[model samples]
Target: MGRGYRRVHLEPAGAQHICANRPGARPSFGQTGVESSAMSRIRLAASLVGLLLGAACVPPPGDALEERIAEDPTLLRIVDRGELRVGIPTEALGIGADPATPGREASLTTDVAGWIADALGVEPSFRFGTTAEILESIHGGDLDLAFPLMPMTEGAVRSTKRSYTAPYYVAHQRLLLAPDTTGIDDVGKVCLFGDARTQVPVENISPGLEGIRSNDGQGCARMAASGVVDAISAPDLLLYELEASLPGSRLLEPSYNTEGYGAVVQYGETGLAGFVDAVIARAIDDGRWNEAFEARIASLTELAAEPPDLTAEEAGALFPRGLPLE
Candidate 1:
């Protein structure tokens, strides 16, 4: 019943149809087979037109999403298909792991994804790739949802026309400084992993700050270790990983900006977004959220407080200029 919601009706292929003849009447004995077939097509076309004309009157929402999954086409499709297609970045530390890994445990992102699919009574399916690759899949409609771990910043919604749910997890953007570095000002060139989550906010941290690009954390680590760059900017969990791998590099105090990780869906998918938010809110209340976080990410970084839920408008105001979705 909400604005922006649409309900589509489709006729099943090869389905039986009523004849164009008079009600309860069969084709005349003198009618040819070709004449009958042409009449049937004409009737079908009229039926299609009626369906289109009535499309504006979407069915009201049931007691909840369970009673009428058809209220949201994306959710309905996921349920009908029996799977929730989720995307996670392969390179993001503590986000998710390859499901194919032997004896691999579910990561925080995967656990949250499972909660979502479970609520919908569908299987959670994951695809792993770089953030860009994942975004491409989302924009290309190859993915139903994505956990790119992108910050819910001001420009997030406008970045690619994709919708982001409230943050299920949050962290601050930190700097990994070279040996003997005092602070951000002490560092010359900063190595950005070329992620909009980091680069967009980190670039404006200091006036006239110069940023160099690396394809991944390993490259950034090597560059920092070899003195190629004075600092590497990223989230706390990633900075922790880089600090351990790159000796003499220290994670500086006082983060530059905060980052919130939210699930992404196609634009106008408010139905799916609301469902995702409910799943996360339930997880937070039932302790599943903390359990997953402790099991997967606690060892790497500690949170000052529980992550907050944000509206798209609030997210943009809190942390502006998020990643540009292509």
Candidate 2:
């Protein structure tokens, strides 16, 4: 696959020069009318003006901002101009949302962006759009990269020139519920977060069923909070984020299933894909990935002390027969 990356553009810093010269003073003209005191005032004003100009002309702190941007591989192009632009979804399944929280709109894509920023040693800058919009922006050369929790469908992978990195997180539809909900452990009604009448059976729920609905993760979490639905189904990590957002909400003891999550680069950007993968690999190897996961999971665990009610069979069924990652 192929993709393109763009540099961020920064506006020039604004500056003002303070001139001390009087409105119509002329140093060359004979001081016939001007008194000595007046001449002293003009000289003082001129000196002050020169001092101000010199101070203003001094470059700002060795161009620290630009220097920091330059040190980051992912932000070199952006920092050179002083801004970083990354694409994210306006709303997505459980991966991205227009979050109520400042700076973060509940989504996996945000987490991925944070990781990318850490790798680049710069703060992440997020640009929100729909999944199609984000992908289109990247493909159209308007965005350097995208971080939507896009599923790796064959058609999706083939249709875009964008390259993908190795899976960073596994995401699969999972059931979420009120901490006190009971008697509905079959995972059928538990998975459906929308209309109660359209509830589908667990076996009947396919990957297609996991499409992005109007009630996104936050909306679903809000619904759970408002007692609209007893449960919801979404990516495990996203469910965790939502649980954190919605009080009294919790993930069912066992997850519904698992899906893979990867980074999105502009079409044909093989080199950037490799670069991103290397950064992710390093994060995984350096224990940063586990640290981030455990921190989020720990918060979720503390919210409720009851252990998930998954039976051995249920746990096994959620993953491959004997997958250790399960």
Candidate 3:
């Protein structure tokens, strides 16, 4: 197995310059129509225009950030490098939507990364990879911050090698079953991705039921839709996203287990972890996190008998303010 993740593109800081010259009044040829007062006003206007235009392109404070870097070597190293390498899993839905465009993505993970990147005064450069790869990257310093597939608090055991910020949301292991299946009900025909990263965990959590491990979620969902398998288990949010393709299919009444999710940093980089937790804290405090679920995961409302509660912290997040950073 690869020991670390591969590097991707780097986003450079937006640099800008301001230049202004006083409008000179010529003494030759003809009479200078413009008076000294007019020239002064013109100069003032030019100065203001330059100031505003230059301000538009200014990046965050380099020196102050550098000073903090001195205090926290991890932060300084990342800031001085000018970009925060982010490892993301493309297979994750709701948390990290796949079927993305060329450069950027719109999701809670990207939004979270963007927030922390701003606070750190660095651009977040994303690398698309698997959950295992992201965790390896975080441990090896190939990534500055990562949406490590590992859950933070709820149902999460601390890793010996990686440090974690407070969890941002909780995702549960949900079961989606087909209307009619050809197999025996003695053991539900559970579908899983062939990759061990996806299979091992689901298998460990859901024992006894026989699993039909495959290559991807779409295949598993397809099996369920055609009644080829009795059930397919994945993140509830992912199953909900795939529901449109599976008619008459149903989500199992109760979630099997809840797993928290959050960014994971390298171990002993307490400063970076604290900074990451602080960003999540501000988002939840200001209602952006709550507002985000309403906008993105609104379909979750229709999936249940009653309307889903967006106000409550149902995701096993670092509650009230945030999850502890360790």
Best by lDDT: 1
229-308: candidate 2 lDDT, tens digit per residue: 56676556456666666666666555444444566777676555655665455445545455544433455543222212
TM-scores of all candidate predictions against the true structure: 0.66, 0.53, 0.59
* Residue-level lDDT tens digits of model 3 in 233-270: 77565666565457766666556555556677777777
Q: After superposition, how far is residue 224 of candidate 2 from its true place, in Å?
A: 4.2
Instruction: Look at candidate 3 and give me any clashing residue pairs.
Output: 194-214, 318-323
Write down the RMSD of all candidates, one decimal each. 14.2, 16.9, 13.2
Q: After superposing candidate 1, which stretches have Cα over 4 Å from the reference?
A: 1-70, 100-105, 178-190, 196-215, 227-230, 247-250, 302-305, 319-326
Angstrom error of the Cα, residue 57, model 3: value is 17
Best by TM-score: 1
Q: lDDT of all the models against the reference?
A: 0.61, 0.46, 0.54
